[model samples]
Target: MIKPSSPTPDHLRELKFSCLDQFIGPFHYTNLIFFYQADAAAADDDENGYKSQALKQSLSEILTVFYPLAGQVVLEGNSSINCNDNGVAFVEAKVLDGRQLSDMIEEPNLEELKHFLPTQHFVVEDNIVLLLQVSFFDCGGIAVGFSFLHKVGDGKSMGEFMTAWANANKYKCNKCKCRCDDQFMNNFNLASLFPPVEFLRTTSLPSTTNLSEKFVTKRLILDRKKLTDLKEAIVSAPGSQLKDPTRVEAASAFIWKHYIIDSAAQKRRQIKLQPNVDQVEVVVENAFMAQHTVDARTRMNPPETNVFGNCFLIAATEIVNYNDQQQEMHHLAYLLRKAIKKIDGDYIKQVQIEGERYFTNLFQRLDPVLKGKLGLCSFSSWCRLPFYEVDYGWGKPLWVCTTPIPLKNLVVFISTPSGDGIEAWINMLEDDMKIIRIE
Candidate 1:
């Protein structure tokens, strides 16, 4: 375990989770891995003691600001954090005997990458909010993997904490006061605005960990030209409602289209034994839904992107008539855009006013799909997130990616270093992925 180099100060201890935090509950952890080429400048020792020390010291200092990360998540009394500075689980691992970095990551094996992550395997204890693992490869390359419980933070929150830590390391400010804490506190007022409800206590976030299905994760890179063509096609396609769509909208539309096509074929194959029900009609009737987790920091009134915690919600759009012959890419993009637009300041305010009722209605609609009644496709785009900006005193990471997600029909998009393209880390059933890869 990686303990803090110095003990946490008593004054900056307990941290509370906001009502938004209660929405997601405490089951999932978001994982990220960064790879760096070994620094040629520091070749003194094989252990790379200097780099490790810098990382540990900077992390300990930053814990003072991002204090809740080091503490445990408490489910009792409305679910808050006891920021006692217990420290994060830090691990050091060596790459396989004969493997080089290229060999390991050329076509990433998600299960193998999980070995480099802290904890036994995505286990979240009550007190552990953050865990990190640093792996040293024989080729002088290093992989840094870390995960934080979703209860205390979201992608934005994690990115902020990482950026702060990197800043501390780059400047050699072991005791630097962080401005991020101020931004983190700004989100506290939102708690009163959007208070918790009784329904949340009874509602359980659906777990989609299906052991029967074989899951696989694969990387799909959309370079500048491909992305541009997609956007152009989405905007110009028949039934197109949008004049100019964002890159994410274009990519989502493309992926959703292909996913629906594959699902339709899969449905056809499954219903060959049952001739009574029309498979085409069934496919059209039960179209897969696309849900995107939208970060509302900028969407909120007075627009605050600097705040911390789970300041986001899922915006879902339905896809009907999956087997339609027409070009539905534009329509898909339109539907996604419409759903995202609904998550405006007024919608947030309505949730604040109708907190319990809002969540109750939400659960009623969501609980069914979580129980495997329907096919759901989820996306979380980290294209705008500054994950690559993390320097950590050793220079920028050569590659940043995520491990295999446990659930299927999920895609997480991250920006390439060039900032012109997006890397989609897609997870789905093995057979489905094989079909998807061909598409």
Candidate 2:
């Protein structure tokens, strides 16, 4: 890993953490990789070397404003960043065996994509807050991979940091007189809003770890037309009161339904194998729920989207029955709408009032999933986020994608560069993926 060109300023040491930061539960790095086609002329002109130096230099400047990222998270007194200006881990790699970027994009594979990320797994150690890798391909294509602790911030914060760094690189902010640090002050004073609960300090939250060999990740694209068609079908269906289900709701409902179908089918297969079991007594238990991620920025009275900490929460719907296809789709979408709608201003106030009790109950709800009795489909929407806006003086990325997530039944939605479609990056069991592909 390449270290920062210069050490962090001594005055910026000891970054403080808000209660919102502690709510992130565990230390896990969110990953993404942006791809760019190889520049033919630059291939012979040593542009890759130039690009690497530019990124490192710009990152050093960006760290001054985002000082917390440059340091490590420590548990002194409470959980906060040491901000010692140690520096972030940055590295460069090459696509092995002359593989081109298109080869991986055309037929996306989680196993191959994992190689692009700097980490061997999702675990964040050594006080490392961020990990970045710039990979070069034989065809001159470059894939910029980024992995950062979710505790640092949510997708919105990540997008903001990326844009700021890119701008610093493109414009050389040292020449500009404007103070950029003022722009990154949203993360301050979050503790007053969501006070840290003592229970969080006493008990560790449960985390699920699925076998990598047993899981597979796939990318499913739904264009505007397709989403419109799905929404229309939902509205036109029998007993439908919905006017227009959003792209995220529709896609999530559709994908969740497919997961249920595949799961139930697998249960049936297992039942058939047991010849001694009574068919009538053999109950195929199927319970599913959606953990829809909601950004707390707009939910607050004054709007805190600019806040730097993890200002996001999960709004989970009630258990959705796996019934007929069309019926389930509409029901899931309606439940999702209701759940998300409840997360407005009042909800934020309630959370602040409830505090520890609220967080404890939220943690308890995952017990079923932790015990392998329930299926939780976690969906995070990055559709409206400005991930594609990071220019870095090389033009916007040709394609922005993420690697396979470590969790099962986790799906992330990204907006296509054209802003006309949603790309669902889904992670599931290998058997379930086979069923999804076949159906």
Candidate 3:
């Protein structure tokens, strides 16, 4: 356990989670893995030990600032945490077999990749808000992984926390102590904007934890040329809403099209198997939905980025019945773009005006999917997130990866080191994996 280097101030002793945070639940964790390859020859155990010590010491310093991470959540109310400097979980692992980072990550299996991260299951009582692990490879490559409780924050908060950790390492001095300026600080003003409430407790969020079907997470990488081609193809579609298509839009649409095609295939097979049904190939045109979490920070500047909690709202695409092959991926991309566009300044105000009711209404929209009345898929993009900016004197990571996500029908987009390529990890049923593999 890595406690704060010092005790938290009395004034900042209690920190409340936002309504959105409560709704997100502590059952889930936001996981990230950063792999770094040294420029010179592989460092020995002594050298790696020194590096780990540096990281541990720096982590202690940052906990004093990002104190919520070191605190315990009250499971009863599920509202606030006691900032008592209880500390975080930190682990260091060495590959038992003589394996290098490059070999391990070359063709990453999501389940195998998860081993590098911490906290596969959350122990509710402990309320250890954050857990970090440092995995050492035989060839000096290091993988820094973390498991952050979802209720504490979202992707934006996790990104900023990483930045804070990196800064703490960069700004620290062994000789003397110095107070960092406001630029290095973060605000917890979200509680004021979206205060803690018991009303939202009844509202249910989508979960796949109890799923009967075996789920698998697969990563699909689109290189620069492939991504560019996809964008061009999407833009070239006649009557497409897209003037210029983004990687997320193009990729989302591409996956959506496949899903629709697969749905049609599934329908045809069912029809053939049914006793009374006509044995004919059925081309099913189903209404599907797309959901994405849009960070409010993306629409803000400066200080806004530093204000964290669950600072994001869901962007749900319009009900889509995609049967037209000529429309291609453009239609779905347009729908996604439209949904995301609604998350503007006006929408932010609506969230304020409607308060927590807005979130309730937004989640209620997914009732159809929750009831199995609508086809659904969720997308979360970390392409331009601060995961790329993490530098602790040794320099930025060589690669950034996510752990196994149990949520079925979810696509997580991470950016390649080049920033031009996209690595999309899709979590779906084991049977669906065959369909995905073919595509």
Q: Pick the candidate with the highest lDDT.
A: 2
* lDDT (tens digit, per residue) of candidate 2 on 250-301: 9988887777778777777877788887754444256777889899888998
The lDDT per prediction is: 0.74, 0.77, 0.76
Candidate 2 — number of clashing residue pairs? 1
Instruction: Output the lDDT of residue 230, model 2.
Output: 83
TM-score of 2: 0.90
lDDT of model 1 at residue 325?
51
Per-residue lDDT tens digits for candidate 1, residues 1-439, read: 5555566667546555556777875367789988876644453354566667777887776776666677777666655677677788777777767676776567667677787787655546546789888787766777888788887888888888888877777777634344544545544344555566665654545556675677888778899999999999987777678988998998888898888777667777777767898655664445577889898788878787776778887888854555565328888888899989899999877776887776677676666567655667789999999898887766788788888876778899999868889888888878778777423
Root-mean-square deviation of every model: 2.9, 2.9, 3.2
Better of 1 and 3 by TM-score: 3
Clashes of each: 1, 1, 0
Off by over 4 Å in 2: 1-12, 75-78, 174-179, 211-213, 272-284, 325-327, 437-439
Model 1 has an lDDT value of: 0.74
In model 2, the Cα lDDT at residue 260 comes to 75
